[model samples]
Target: MTDQYAVLGNPVTHSRSPFIHACFARQQHQRMEYRAIEAPLDGFESCVSQFLQGDGKGVNVTVPFKEQAWRLAACRTPRAELAGAVNTLWRDESGQLWGDNTDGIGLVTDLTQNVQVKLEGARILMLGAGGAVRGVIQPLLDAGCSQLFIANRTAEKAQLLVEQFAPLLPEGVLLQGGGYTSVPSDGEFDLIINGTSASLSGDLPPVNPVIVGAHTLCYDMMYSARPTAFCQWAITHQAARAVDGLGMLVEQAAEAFLCWRGVRPDTAPVISLLRQSLA
Candidate 1:
């Protein structure tokens, strides 16, 4: 039988993982079956257990269930441990459940490879203090950015993130967090990433427009058929480039695919396919 895999979550009907993984498997000529499974909101643990007991090899957990998956895993990769969540899950020969988070690597890879936005030595401003932001912090720091300031409406929430990751801060790098109003005006930001759900609801993060310099790159972690509100804000401010997370979505799925199948698929074609479909 072909190896089986899936993505699990509540309201997973709209997930593009099946299509993304299908393209990857076909590209590498791997015999695998990937699909989406919508688990009941309160039955996440039971649902995942049922799948793994069957022919399921691994499954990607999303949204509300990621934290639940993290708790259920017998082992976790360091990234997943820091994230306090798990998006990818598998098992060892001993049947011990293992979890890892590919979100940060996904975002970093997309920005560096697909978007060609340099991360090394770059000054980055990230807007958000939620789980979505937490999953990507270590990887962003690991990318060797010179400075990363995380801003949120609740200043204390952002500061908590700063404290949590302080021990892992790289040499010659500065990491800080505060309210949006606390964003520095001393220098232009090399990159601004909107990790907030503001763009999903068509709202821009409350930050000054002066942060966008001539060469600044603005990226929204949310993607839509049209420009995200943050992307529109970037364009209106004359930022050098405005990008969405579609590439990150594809790249992350590719990372999970590699974990399951041990082969990395080319992401460029999958990203192009998703963009065209979104348009």
Candidate 2:
């Protein structure tokens, strides 16, 4: 029997997950169908329960539903536990649901493999302290960045993240957090990531433009057909590269596919196809 899978979110019609996963399934010769599911804002649990009861093999949870999925799972991977969010979910032979967060690995892979940005010894600045940022922190720290700074509008949220992840830092690495206005003025970062929702609203973070320099690489964890607000900000600041999250989205889907199918599909062509379609 062909497997059934889907991505669940509010306002999910705009999702590219179905297209991305279809490409993977086709490339890997897997017998599966992927679709988008828009769960009602307050009815996510009920919607997911119904889907699973109807023979759904797996599902990807997005936005506000990720934390709910984490709570719903019978078990979770270590990364998911650290993130306190779940993006991928599947059931075992015993019918127990398991959750995992593939966001961090996806972001790291896209930054190092796809974008060719060396994270080792790189000074990094990340915007936002929400679930998106939480999902990527441990992996970025593990990737060997020398210093990581997280800035958010509400300073306490960012500081909480710093406190939570500080113990995981490798020797010689530093992690700090504060309000956007508190971003250090002493030095520039090699990499800056916008994990905030600012791009969706076409608003830039209230950060100093000086944080971006000629050698800096800026990435927004949001993608669109046109340049994202953060991407435009990077360009305006003459940053070396301005990237949207298309690559990360595809890479994360590929990781989730691997988790479900035990096989990895090539992502470059899928990303290219999605890019062209977006255009």
Cα RMSD to the true fold for all candidates:
0.9, 1.0
**Cα-based lDDT at residue 226, candidate 1:** 92
Tens-digit lDDT string for candidate 2 (1-279)? 678999999989989999999999999999999999999999998888888877699999997799999999999999999999999999888999999999999999999999999999999999999999999999999999999999998999999999999888889999999999889978789999999997777777898988888899999999999999899989988999999999999999999999999998999999999999999
lDDT of 1 by residue, 171-234 (tens): 9999999999999988889999999987776667889998899999999898888988899999
TM-score of 2: 0.98
The TM-scores of all predictions, comma-separated, are 0.98, 0.98
Clashes of each: 0, 0
Evaluated at residue 153, the lDDT of candidate 1 is 87
TM-score of 1: 0.98
Task: Pull out the clashing pairs in model 2.
Answer: none
Q: Clashes in candidate 1: how many?
A: 0
Name the 10 consecutive residues with the lowest summed lDDT in model 2.
Answer: 198-207
Q: Between which residue pairs do clashes occur in model 1?
A: none
